[model samples]
Target: MDRKKFLKNGLLGLGTIVALPTAMNSCTKDDSIDATNDNATDGSNSSGSGDCTLSPSETAGPFPIKTPADLVRENIVGDRDGVAMLINITVQDQSEDCAPLAGVYVDLWHCDADGNYSEYGGTGMQSTNYTNVHFLRGRQTTDSNGQVSFISIFPGWYNGRAPHIHIEVLKTNGSSIRVTQIAFPKSICDTVYSTSAYKGTANMLNENDNVFSDSLEDNMADSVTGDTTNGYTLTKTIVV
Candidate 1:
């Protein structure tokens, strides 16, 4: 869907970036974890039961297709080619004493390996009929663990921005609550781009990206593990 449709249907609307609170980097034990919870894995410090700092909001970037019939699935890559990646997102509610938020719908979408967005205009792509073909876009519902994971390809870079993934959290009734983007570490991005499929022009660093220039939002960076040859796992908590 286009930007008009997305805003009309409770998805993200075009607006100024929402910087993450600086205190999130130093969140104290008062924002502690719940003893009964066990959703964390792969060395993630974020837990579902803690009163986490609210994640910063971000622009939806003019390419989200948030219609009712777009289809929701765990594997968003389809047949797209690039290094494999696993994105693990944990959604926690800052309002409910930081309880694990279940049944929330998480929308994840990104460009392909060549920096071409699936349903958007790009070089060598059909700009006039971009919406007809949808790829690298999908949604997954958070389980009891407050986690929704997706299998996708490592995203590539384009002009004036860094490599990142857009994520939106919608309530059970389909109303959007939080909109944000996740960034990969520069070192990890370097390693991923070394592969032949991603060896094109490099992306701008986070400080150069307009949306990520705010220092407080640095927490948006993912905890990435693994390599280009064996695939990678990117994990982050979505505190809304």
Candidate 2:
């Protein structure tokens, strides 16, 4: 499918739509994998053993990256400040006995430490203006192991949503496969938010988030190991 058409179909197919509040502060409001046979935490198949099912499809907006092909890089931390984090995503083919699926492109983006997304802001929904800068956004292709890693700062939270990352998996031809969001563990969120860069408490938690509350078993990270002192690593597997 053409990228534009895919995005249009995705938006129209959503069962529920959450509205972002206008006049909200930039620091407020909201807001994987794999193949079968992988051991993932929280009963997911990322790091601990779990069922291999199709990852839940999610909405790609309020702010989806524009021209994602131009932002391909491993280090996506463009001037955003926060605790360093390494995001590792593995893609698997459920049809092939949960085997690794290599060469697919993964586009990932998230808000910075202030809860402000790049390429959007200075509006009623996001008070800070970041329209010209493209931070915290990048794309990379899965390797032979069907894994892609990104260097980013721990994301900050805003009102109405929890700290999360948005990812879209596409075939080499640019056709969309899955668009999903990943949730951070509350324990890790608490520790990351307490740091100087992300000083306030998150107004929303995974249990309270509209998108994650019901599908957290598959949406939440399999493991989030590390601390503010040494940075963190988030690993999850997505099966499609």
Candidate 3:
């Protein structure tokens, strides 16, 4: 079977479970957390069982700059300002018996807190010009434990779309094995949007998003606990 077709088909069933490590589970507490400062030992890779499903694949959207070769760092928040956010992603090869996919390249990019994507067209929320601003976009290689994390801000909302982040998983040779978008819990979005830093006021829901609506159960990201006040840590396990 083609790798791309297999991934899409596998996600249609009960295969997209995002397991969190015990260490990164501190968000359950209501106290404030320093997500950026704790980057050394923040997220954990490998879910005990490899039986979990892969994250559902979705469109890369209208703004995607940089290629696999451009990935040089783990921290993609290049001068963007907003509430702190930590994205913890684990990639495993389901085709290879759910083995940890070490050395895999994971690309993550999203819009800024103002609902604008850098280096892309800005039509509705702002001007119709493209800028060299490349915040909230970065790449990281999976470790021996099949884990890669990014330090960013809770994504802002925009028209015709829900609060989400785009991720592309590729092999060491830069061949894309999986492409998908991670959706945020609506409750979290509401809480984050209430803050002053995030001024974008688009109220689109997961059920309304065209791509996510078809696979809401499998596409919706696992529930996260932290808020904008304490910063957020989103953990997900992706089986490719």
Candidate 4:
């Protein structure tokens, strides 16, 4: 979708700042963890049925994480405040009958609770200045089950984009495999945004988002089971 040029032409000089909510000193224990969807099956494929398909390649958006190698940890929430979310991504190989592709590297990044990215802000695209901080960005290697999980806050929405998360898969040699995004269901998003930390609802929806409009439901996490009080768990399997 030529997202780079789109951001350069349409996002610059927007001069609109999304209101930031009060940040809590620390996330509550209940919200930070304890809500796990262990029985939720993988719903990342195009069809809801139990089958694997190659995840569509997507843009990294304008705010790609800087120095991902320096941010290797399971907990990506650094001083950000919102409903805690556990993102579980499973990587599979399409050539090998969608078997678990273990030992690969997964990089995941998303905006903070206030709809502001960590390392790139304080500019026309993002009004909040967070250049000095690194939050909601992390990299982890897949386990034997081809799964990598991150502890982060449920992301807040920006102007024209829906609530989503960016992910990049890399081989053992550090070469890129695919860049894609994870989408949240509208019901889940509405519920999360209604929380006190989120301040309000999103300005856009998944069907209307420029990136996810084109049959991107294949990347949507259908098994997001949890409440706003205890946090949520998003599980998706990406085939590459």
Number of the top lDDT candidate: 2
Off by over 4 Å in 2: 1-49
Model 1 clash count equals 0
Question: Could you give candidate 1's per-residue lDDT for residues 1-240 as a string of tens digits?
Answer: 132332223212211111211212322222112122121112222233324766666778867765624658766776667877667788988888767899999998888887777766643542444555677888888988798777677898777778889889998788898877887666667777887888565658765666665522434443566666656667788888
- Those runs of model 3 whose alpha carbons end farther than 4 Å from true positions after fitting are 1-51, 122-130
Compute each candidate's TM-score over C-alphas: 0.73, 0.79, 0.75, 0.79
What TM-score does model 4 achieve against the real structure? 0.79
- Residue pairs of candidate 1 with colliding backbone atoms: none
- What lDDT does model 4 reach? 0.72
Superior by lDDT: candidate 2 or candidate 3: 2
How big is the positional error of residue 194 in model 2, measured in Å on the Cα after superposition? 0.9
lDDT of 2 by residue, 82-149 (tens): 77777778898877877999999999999988889999998999999999999899999998888887
For residues 43-86, could you state the per-residue lDDT of candidate 4 as single tens digits?
23332234666775777889988888999987777787887676
Which is the winner by TM-score between candidate 1 and candidate 3? 3
How high is the CA lDDT of each candidate model? 0.65, 0.74, 0.65, 0.72
Error of 3 at 228 (Å): 1.8
Ten-residue region with minimum lDDT total, candidate 2: 13-22
Q: Which pairs clash in the backbone of model 4?
A: none
